[model samples]
Target: MSQKQKILIAIAGPTAIGKTALAIEVARYFNTEIISADSRQFFKEMSIGTAKPNPQELAQAKHHFIDSHSIKDDFSVGNFEKQAIACLGKIFENHDVTVMVGGSGLYVNAVLYGFDELPKASDALRAQLNERLKTEGIELLQEELKNLDPDYYAEVDVYNPQRIIRALEVCLSTGKTFSSFRNKQHKERDFDIILIGLNTDRELLYSRINQRVDLMIKDGLVEEVRALQAYQHLNALKTVGYSEIFRHLNKEWTLSEAIEKLKQNTRNFAKRQITWFKKNEGIIWFEPTETQQIIDFIKEKLITTTK
Candidate 1:
C-alpha cells in the first residue's frame, strides 16, 4: 500500500508530548478527521486520567473513537483494528490523508500490521493471573514478562494488568513467549502510512508527565475516581492515576503519597511509551514546538507518495 493514493498519517509518542494537538493541526490542514488510536480515551468514563482532548480540541477537528465506548464493554485490540479500518474507509472517501494519534503501541501496531490470533488461555488460567495481580502486585508479572518476552516488555505498558496478564497467560499456557505470536508480516491496507513521532529530553518529558498528573489531580481526578468506586475492580479503573487514588481511598496510602505515586507512575509510563515508538524507524521524530516542520514534512511525503 506504499503507493496507494490514500494515506493514514499516524502521530505517535509518549503521553503529554502533544500528539493530540499535532494531530488536530494536521487534520485541520488536510480538512480531514482524526481516528484516535488511544486505547484509554475510548471510554466515556475516563477523562482527566486519560488526558482526553478538551472541548476546544474536539471542535477544532472532527474526531472519531474518543469517548465512543463504555468501560463495561469489552473492546479488544483486534476489535479496534477492525473498527479503525472501517472508520478510515469513510475518512478516505473525502480526503487523501487522515490522522491517527495515540501513545498506545499495541493498538497502533494492530492497525498498521494485522493482529495475530494468539492462543487463548482457559478461564482458570486468567483467574490465576488475576489472583497473582491481587496478591503479588503487577511488579512480579512485569518482571516475569521481561524475562519471558523482553521484546514485548520493552514496549508494553507494564502497568496495564490486562495486557500483562494476557501476555503471561499466553506464555504460561503455550510454553512459548507471548511476543512469539505477534505479527511479523505487515498487513496490506488501502492507505499508505506516514508515521510521525514526538519527543523531548528525558528530564523535560518526565517533568511534563509530573506536571500533567498534578493538573489531573487539580482538575478533580480524585472526585472522578471516587464516583466510580463501585467499578474500581474493572480493568479500565486499574490504571495508574485511578489506582493510586483508589489506594488512598482504601486507606492504604495518604492522599499526598497517592499523588506522588501517580506522578512517578505516569513518568514511568511515558518512558515506556518512548521506548515503544522509538523502535519504529519509520516514524520521523520532532519536538512538540516543531508543528510547522511536521506539517511541511507531511506535505512533502504526500507529494512523493502520490508521484
Candidate 2:
C-alpha cells in the first residue's frame, strides 16, 4: 500500500471568529494535536488581550506554540516557520492528520507555503529605518510603503512599525516591491494541507470583535497591560488591545476613548485578516458554526485520498 499523506488541517479566520473552539472540536474528532499559528498567542505574557484559549479549551486538545515563548524572546515569523515545521514532524509520527489554527495569515502561510528568500536587512539599514520612524513619523513611512508596495500596505497592519520597517528595508535594499517577492516559489512540505476558512456577515463579525474586546476588558485586559508595562516596548505588545490601552495609560486618551479605540482597531484588524485570507483561493470557506459539515467535508476528502 502507498504511504498515506500526512494531512495538516489549517483552521483559519479573523479574530473573534471562534477559531479556537472550532479547532478543538476538529482536533478532537481527528484524535490528534493542534499547532497554533497565532502570533499573539505565542507569548506567555499576553493571554487576556490576545484572547488566548482558556485552560478548559487547552485541556480539550493537545496544543503547541500557545504560550511557548516569553514576551522577552525575539520570536520572528522565520523562527516560527522553523519551529512549527519541527513540531509537525513530531505530530505526524502518531497521527495521520493534525490541525493548525490561527488568525495570523503570514504565520499560517509560512507553514503551508514556505516564505520566499528576500534580501536581508543590514544593521545600518535597520538603524536608518528606525531613525526615520523616530524623526519622520509613521505617516511618511506608510506613504512610502503605499507607493512602493500598495498591495501589501492594503493588507498589512499599518500601525505596526516592525512590519512597516521590514517592508521598507526590502524596498530600499532590493529596489523591489515587498509583495512581489511573496509566493514566488513554495518549498515542498511533506504533508498535504487542507485550508478551512471561517467567515460570516461583516456586521456580525464586527459585532463579535466589539463584544470580544469588551469581554477582554472585563477580564482585566487593563490589568494585564499594566502588569506588562515594563515590557511595553516589546514588539509583541505592539498589538491592538495592548497598544490602545498603553496610550490610555500614557494619559494620551481617556479610558473610555481607549476602549472605543480598541474596539475600532480590533474591527479594523479583523477586516485586514479577511482581506489577507480571501486572497488564498485554496481555502474552503465555511460559517464559523458549521462544525459537523466541516468534519464531514474533511472525512470525504480523506476517503477520496485513501481510495
Who wins the lDDT comparison? 2
Lowest-sum lDDT 10-residue window in model 1: 1-10
Instruction: Give one digit per residue, the lDDT tens place, for model 2 in 1-307.
Output: 1224888999999999999999999999989999999998999989999999999999999999999999899999999999999999988888899999999999999999996777898999999999998899777999999999999998898777889999999999998999988989998998888899999999999999888888998999999999998888777888789989999999999999999999998888889899999999999999998999999999998877657
Q: What clash pairs does model 2 have?
A: none
Q: Give candidate 1 misplaced runs (Cα > 4 Å).
A: 1-3
Q: List the residue pairs that clash in candidate 1.
A: none
Candidate 1 Cα deviation (angstroms), residue 84: 0.6
Tens digit per residue, CA lDDT, model 1, 89-186:
88787788899999988899988887888998999999989999999999999999999999889878877899999999999999999888887688
